[model samples]
Target: MTRLLGFPIADHRRVFIIALPMIISNIAAPLLGLVDTAIIGHLPDAIYLSAVAVGATVIGFIYFLAVFMRMSMTALVAQNFGADDMAAQRHNSINGLFLAALLGVLLILLTPAVLELSWWLMVPAPALQNLASDYISIRLWGAPAALMNLVILGVLLGRQQSRQAMWLVIATNAVNVIVDVWLIVILDWRVQGAAVASAAAEWSSCLLGLFWLRKSLALGWHHLRLNLKQLLVLLRLNGDIFVRSLTLQLCMASMTAYATRYGAIYVAVNAVLMQFLLLISLGLDGIAYAVEALVGQAKGQGRSDRVRHWCRLTLLWSCLFAVAYSLIFIAFGEHIIRLLTDIDSVIDTAGHYLPWLMVLPLIGHWSYYFDGVFIGLAQSRGMRNTMLFAALLGFLPLWWWGQRFENHGLWLALTGFLMMRGVAQAIWLKRHPQTLL
Candidate 1:
């Protein structure tokens, strides 16, 4: 018991077993963006890169709004697993996939309207509107496959099948990169090619994921049938997470919208910088995924003590990793920027704001870790509330005030928002420990 409390070697092993594969997978996932950006960024014109950035942001906004499916699936499946309820786990996965399919179809249907509305909101320059529109038009074709992949991934993580989950992500991105190079570089299909590659990869991976889970699919179909009661429960959980994810994506989209006001150059620069930030968030998320699985399992077993232990050790390691990210960025961030784009102006502008990038990991790491903790505890409402407070109260006001500083102001507001979320959630968890049990 003493050894367990003192960061036992066994605990570290458990954490890494789950975290390492996730970390590798998460890292690979964002490289999709990096690869796209790098390929497009090298174009003779920066407009293509900016258009992809804006288009991707719009697609991400829609996709993330639907990502509540992923989050809820992970938590509930993890809890069910911990309680040794395999039937419930299978049921959840089946329900989640059905919902993912419906939602994806809805997104495809709404793409035209969404694209028009997005342009109105973003108000990009005339030249950019058509290019971005073309990119988005092609990308939405894969909406069904993309959302389905999210469910498969969430279920995989919930089942603690990290290695399998890693492969799914790797395969998806690998196909994306190969297609990206083939069409964009070899055939000069440009931004449209990037979109096609992404869409194709999604379809390919969805088929692969279904094939991989054929055995589970067979068992799940036999053991249970879907029903309204179970789905309602999932929907209620997904509802809160939906709002939370939507708000989060909106806040992120605002950064891109704001950048558009400054011109395609600024948009291009922000895209590159945002990619760096994405890498950091996803990398740290590897640790948070472990927290979600372990803490959630502990909660299912009614073992609050185990919940506390996993949270503590995971938090320690996540923060350490966050600090390491900051240091690496400090040392070599400019070089990374150079690798992403040959545009001299983009590189210089990105370097100016590089300090903000260095500090963001430290400020944002807590929120990422706490999100996992709350999700594991099935405290969806708390997650929603904290994010609202952070975005509405902390981020917007700081952003408003920081406008005096231009792009630096945008970074400042985002930093405050992240800090507010972490602090608020931490206090809540401290005050209401019952949630964990």
Candidate 2:
């Protein structure tokens, strides 16, 4: 068939064009982490990057945990579209919004505890530690708004309204970039500038997202109601997503904490390395997300043949990208790290590990790719269970065992985590071939 899942190439092209912007916009958010590193790295004080490191790590925990809102919302909305139910789509968005807000408020309140733990973990120079606290506390205020923006974007993507998701991201990041300069250059707010810029942009983005989401859901305003049945459905779907996110964060946090023991420069440079990982993953993520949306829609319509076609096409694309990614990472790893951080020590630390980084694009690509397929299948419980199991059995054990060693241990543990994900998700997918069918 010339067509893809009955939608035709033209239909996919339209979706792809729209999704490109969302990918670009989404890409900018991760840059802020890089920006934090760059700004602090270039500052008169070398310690600034370390400050950003500790603060960014803490805030990252919040963002990573709440990622479920995006994952679940996208899958749910796509399913509703396939079912031809506009009402269900609207309710899912609303439910995501309410939940996002609740989670954000809770994060704001619990930030003090998070801050305390951060201080305990980092015995960096006292000045650096204080800077970290200030940056983290300021950044925490944006939690609610940032989480809401994530939910809104997910909802838009789910609806195949990729253009809108793109525009929202562009506007938000534009704001973030502007404030980042003004506060850092003019107000001379070092770490404060980076933290506040992120928070302000997040809140601004949430406002913009609300405008878009409200316009889309306005028609069903009077009809939208969450009774027991609907509430249970919403919880079940969102809960699976939540569990998956929690497992991911736990696994990642282990990596972060372990990096700290290697020293701040190591952790800071690795932080930059991780940003590269996110950028590469998100670029390819566009394809995986597209596959998920299409596959879910096909499954909704009970078209197993269409599902098969989409999955095969997606795997083909992933294989091609895998080869390309390995080449790029191997060839340009140093140049990319240099562009992000200027510190000699940080650069050297990263260079030593660049070889392993090359391995990630090829060997580690499956985890990110499978995550998309599982989400599309709405096998959140399976994914969540498998991920958490890996974190405990595969990830945590190695990470804990590695702590007694040098950089080798930390590197081993981190690589082991990604490898476990690839192997475990593959095993899980093979056993549940019904998902592909």
Please give the lDDT score at residue 224 for candidate 2: 47
Candidate 2 TM-score to native: 0.84
Whole-model Cα lDDT of every candidate shown, in order: 0.87, 0.76
Please, what are the lDDT tens digits per residue for candidate 1 over residues 99-209?
888888887898889888998887999889999999999999999899989888887777788898899999998899899999999999999999999999999999988
- List residue ranges in candidate 2 displaced over 4 A: 1-15, 30-53, 123-131, 181-195, 220-224, 259-276, 337-352, 396-413
| Candidate 2 lDDT over residue span 1-437, tens digit each | 36765546775575466446657766775675455456558778877778877788778776877777888887777777777777787777777777788888888898888877767766667888889889988998998898898889888877777778877877776777789788887788888998898899889989988888878866445754544565566678678777877877766665566677778887787678887677667666876777667777776666778777666666666666777877888888899889888998889888988887777777667776777777777778777777776777777788678777766566677678777877888898888888765
How does residue 311 of candidate 2 score in lDDT?
Answer: 67
Give me the displacement of residue 374 in model 1, in angstroms.
Answer: 1.2
TM-score computed on alpha carbons, candidate 1:
0.87
